[model samples]
Target: MEHSSVHHPEMPHIPSTLTLASRTPTVGSARKSETRHILVIYVGGTLGMKPNSENSLAPVAGYLTTEMRRMRELNPPSDDFAQQGSSSSSNSFSSAALSNEMRVPTFDVIEYAQLLDSSDMDQQDWLVIARDIERYYYLYDGFLIAHGTDTMHYTATALSFLLHNLAKPVILTGAMVPLMEPYNDARRNLVVGMMFAASTEICEVCIFCNDVLLRGNRSVKVRHTLSAFSSPNYPALSVMEAQPFRPRRHLLARPPTGPLAIHSDMSGRVMTVLCHPDFDAESVKTMIQGTSKEAESRLDCVVLELMGVGNTTSTMARTLQSVVNTASRVGCLVAITTQDLYGSLTAASVSRLKKSCPDAIFVGDMTTEAAAVKAMYLFGKKLTAAEVKEWMPRNIRGEVTTVASRL
Candidate 1:
């Protein structure tokens, strides 16, 4: 695999034989002397896109890494200054001065052969990424993935499950505007992502976009703004700021006890259904029934993105209940999530629907993307329908908020 590193004349010379080490320091000790090595997988996104002949932004091969190399932020400082960088004070360096210093981080970029518009990403693409991380898990301190904004949350949620017991940061970030654009958010997003990846403070999959470090599964895309993503149900793990970089230690995932395990088995058999005012029962029934016996046999789970707080109109309610009941009878998992970005599918919130579809799994406050990816992960494990139902509500990979049931 070919990779590139940015070099500068003013920066201290990096040794060819220099070893990469984790930024994690021993407890009760000062920072580690070695520089952290981060692997940035540029999988094609707005961050690396340029205008096509049609004037629409599109992924260009090798554009992202080239653009990143042109920026001063991606490169590290000279080896001499980096080796001298043991400061007792975290606030000693000004953000402006730090930007030009050699203390930032050292990283390599692996651009994908085929750049994908995030909308084009699917299970196969996710599998490829998961396998690559697993293949190189031991070689790097942390990893950053540059992906398209359209489906970044889905990819992040998939990776959160795929990379089990993650002990290093796997940050997914992209820009709302193309990197080549005169006014774009790409540079800042990429810089912050690199800094976070090189740190030992976070050890789970996350999305850092528009300065917010959000839990991967908790994030949702906000299409209309420069801050393209937000974590509505949870507090940000950290905020990317200028000058002093202080991560919120309390919000980070607990340290993992075992070596990282990768679970690449994802079943595309899971389906997601949206319940709107115009939803029809027969259409849903057909989806549940499948076109034929063979297809129905392969179906394992369904994620229902229901109306606010898991409610539906009386007509829609009956349709959902009937379909859910049929799905239950067929030993297929049925999970419920609310469309409301800020609320959850608590017992009180879905009381009406629960009365008729008692067996449905309630995924409170999990984003639709998380619900879909989690369902796919669970189904891929070939767990029984009962096990899927039980695990769906559990806080696996921090996908959902567990609350005490009022019932």
Candidate 2:
């Protein structure tokens, strides 16, 4: 990785040795003798992209490590001020100046490869990321993933399910603009994400963008602007932008009760169906068939993005019902998620589905991405349909704020 002085220049130098060995991909000196180390996993995102001579954004050959260094420099710790403030007994002026220095937490960079548009992300990519989380789950106090905005929600949801019983923060963040722009949003979002992951006591995976911290599975890309992710039905786990970066704390989910279990055996046989205005039975059949055919043998689950209140017209409903039946008969688990960004399925939809597919599990109010990953997670657990049917609706790490009584 090449070094640059463009991001932050006011701080002390980071040892190149650490930069080379650590995945954080930073340019900061070794740790401050006492602060605990925070490892940053740069998996590629808008944060490492910059405009080329042609004026289109492209991945800078070595932006990940450079940005990590800049993030540390821009937010150097406050220990110096503590010494300064205490050294002067009655000198209120010096003490005040010292107090003014921000308490910047130091983070180590672990630069991983895969830094690209989040859209390029797929099942293999997700498995690679999950394996990284497992490989480093014990080494670092927390993890920060810089991803592209396009499919951050899916990754977040996937990680939420893949990483079960997490005891530390796993914050996913990205920007509307590339890191190299003069006034790029990546700097603040990335910096704040590091801070959130380091300080939060929450054990669940989360998505942090703009000033909001959303539950990983609940989050969705609601816009193209810098403030792209949101979970309207659920309150933010925390918010950034406050001085000293105090997370709402209250919104953060409770810490896990057990040790982290990184679920590497996730079943990639999951599929998704969107409930569009023009409902077609053939389309539903084709989608399920295509996914199963493409899998050649792996397909084990499917998720339907039902319309408002989880509704599907009788025609489309029958189609989905048939698809669910087919998938179920083949030992595939079929699940339902509402198209509405914030609500759970209605009793009507649940009842209709129950009569048609009797044994299919519903994802309650969770987002589509969450439903997909959760389905994979359950399938991989090798739980019997009866077992998954019972556990899938429960609030596991706050994935779903509510559960349906009907199905």
Candidate 3:
């Protein structure tokens, strides 16, 4: 994908009227500054979109940053605004309140040259974002990814695996409505994302939208409501409350001990097959059984979105087992996750299916998105079949609620 870098010179400056918390004395009576810098990576999404020639909301290059500059919430604190206070006698109080507002961090936006609708995103797009984060990992205190809502969960899950041993906050957010609209969620999402990124509390890749901060790998876009995403199995890490700009913290991932490591070489040879009432065994066989020897060699894994609690019709069960057997015989890993969004793949639930397919690896309560991306990540590392099987069941990045079981 083509891309360009444009620097925004006007950094947000704190107002002089606001009294900051006393800083620790530094060398020779100087005080350490509290300001934080964040790198905002603007990968094309609905948040930055504007009306195109046909008047449909579409991503417009350079438009997002321009609009960001106009928002007073994002802009630097201005003394001029403090001077021209509110009309009532409470002007001083209002000015004082404004002065005491949450300190917005200075950030730079790197817009992709060819903005993409989330639907257009693929493994290569995931690679591009991963590479960008790896390249600028150390330069900024934290990172914010503005992505399209359609595939944001997938990208978030991919990034969680790609940016291994991540030590800083990498918050992903996007808007259902464009930022240019009068009433939109973009501003709040971006603002909350910025606040979280600047803090030292969260160190994992997370998605912040509709007031909830969730683990990137665990979150899924649930509906078309303003609260577009939710972590079905996992609890949210934090909640954004605007009254005093306080974000209530919940469970958080431990900080990494080693330096950040990025794994960009993702193998896209993994296939996800969904089980249904009208499932076709021949098609499943065709997918797992590659047409050519070369194609078969390239195929590494299959993530089957099995029926509730990892079950299927008795007729389809035998066929599915045979397909899994075939896939395993040819060095491809077969991992099974449930189609239901909220249940674990318990041994009791899948006992019948397990009897037919003892080799199938059951991923317990792991989101299909995480299962797919984790398979790709493991395959990209060129792990042996045994190693892949061994690691798939383990909670590498908190993807699975319970240890995966292999019958």
Candidate 4:
């Protein structure tokens, strides 16, 4: 059955938002779990950076490699670097080799070319990251992406779509502070992210921070200072505490059969418009035209950030029409999403999108980040326009959900 967001007449469209009260830690429970081989793909972020002798920050890839190797050496029987799909007997022997006194799980590190800052990340960066995941997909039981929080959600959501039929966990994690800092949050989060990735209970893309694990597609960075990322319209899969981290497995997507397929052919011909208080024809025209020029081929999709309930001032009506005209003429799709994070916009708020651009798709309640990446991934795939239209609203990997508005 097709699922659309539940409608509220009074609040035609609103963005998703949240203010969560911290939950009390789960008490007095004993649960046992297995240790799986995990791959740590370190792309330079705060977690993988440190201040140098000159007081300049540089990628701490060397530090990560040395520390991890030293840890593995201390525990000679460490099975962290062993390849995946090796026989169970082999894994058992490796696990035993590392299991001298303390039975700690082994992990491997593969540091790619590091990004100076996440802000410099672009389409080419995404491709490299996706290919890295592909290269290690068969070699590791699960994977972790240590990315900058600036665009972690985007990477997570993009990879969720790019890596299809994924049966193992792909967890993205980073910290608010650098690992060199005295009390940096990276240590706990990275360790926990790896643990969660290794868990058989989680079979989807996720972002782990502040000890809480959220569904990748549903997560967004909410606070700059705090380690926690929020899933405004959805609940987290699990929250890791002092002792035991309990995962709500029923909330995650079921794994698909067959080997993992990484789609590196993202069109990168999409645009995202940020909404403001005063929007008009001239401004809208400028944004739409500017983005069109930057596309790889013809523009594929344009995601508009609209005001409350997805509505725009009447002055911008022609702007919307112009987007519809230009996009439709060049075989592009234009969509409208709310600037707000707590509520979804109505298709009626973007009525011109539905009528003028018949093939255009509207993203209801999805973050601008997820919507843009999804459009790029789906644009030139074998999927038809109608299929794109339909799939946009469906929860392929729990990216979007059908929930009633409380507005």
**Whole-model lDDT per candidate:** 0.73, 0.65, 0.74, 0.64
Model 1 steric clash pairs: 12-78, 77-102, 95-243
Tens digits of per-residue lDDT, candidate 4, 241-327, equal: 554455776787776876777654776477777756565546644544555454444555778777743234444554566666766
Off by over 4 Å in 1: 1-32, 76-103, 295-298, 308-313, 403-407
Order of models, best lDDT first = 3, 1, 2, 4
Write model 2 residue lDDT over 1-407, tens digit each, in one string.
22222223423343221222332223354443333346676666778787779987866645767656555443433444234335544433223332221223456565543355678877666666666667556656677887888888888887877776777788898888777778978887877687667663657788888888888888888899987988967888766543544556677666655676665467546777776867665765555555544444646667777774334456666666777777666566677787777677667868877776676777677777777777667767776666666767777757777632211
Give candidate 4's whole-model lDDT.
0.64
Query: How do the predictions measure up, each by TM-score?
Result: 0.84, 0.79, 0.84, 0.75
Q: In lDDT terms, how accurate is model 3?
A: 0.74
Error of 3 at 274 (Å): 1.1
Model 1 reaches what TM-score against the true structure?
Answer: 0.84
Supply candidate 2's per-residue lDDT for 110. Answer: 53
* Candidate maximizing TM-score: 3
Quick one: ranking by TM-score, best first?
A: 3, 1, 2, 4
Q: On a 0 to 100 scale, what is the lDDT of residue 21 in model 3? A: 16
Each model's RMSD to truth, in Å?
Answer: 6.8, 6.4, 7.1, 13.5
Residue-level lDDT tens digits of model 3 in 218-242: 9888999789998999988877554
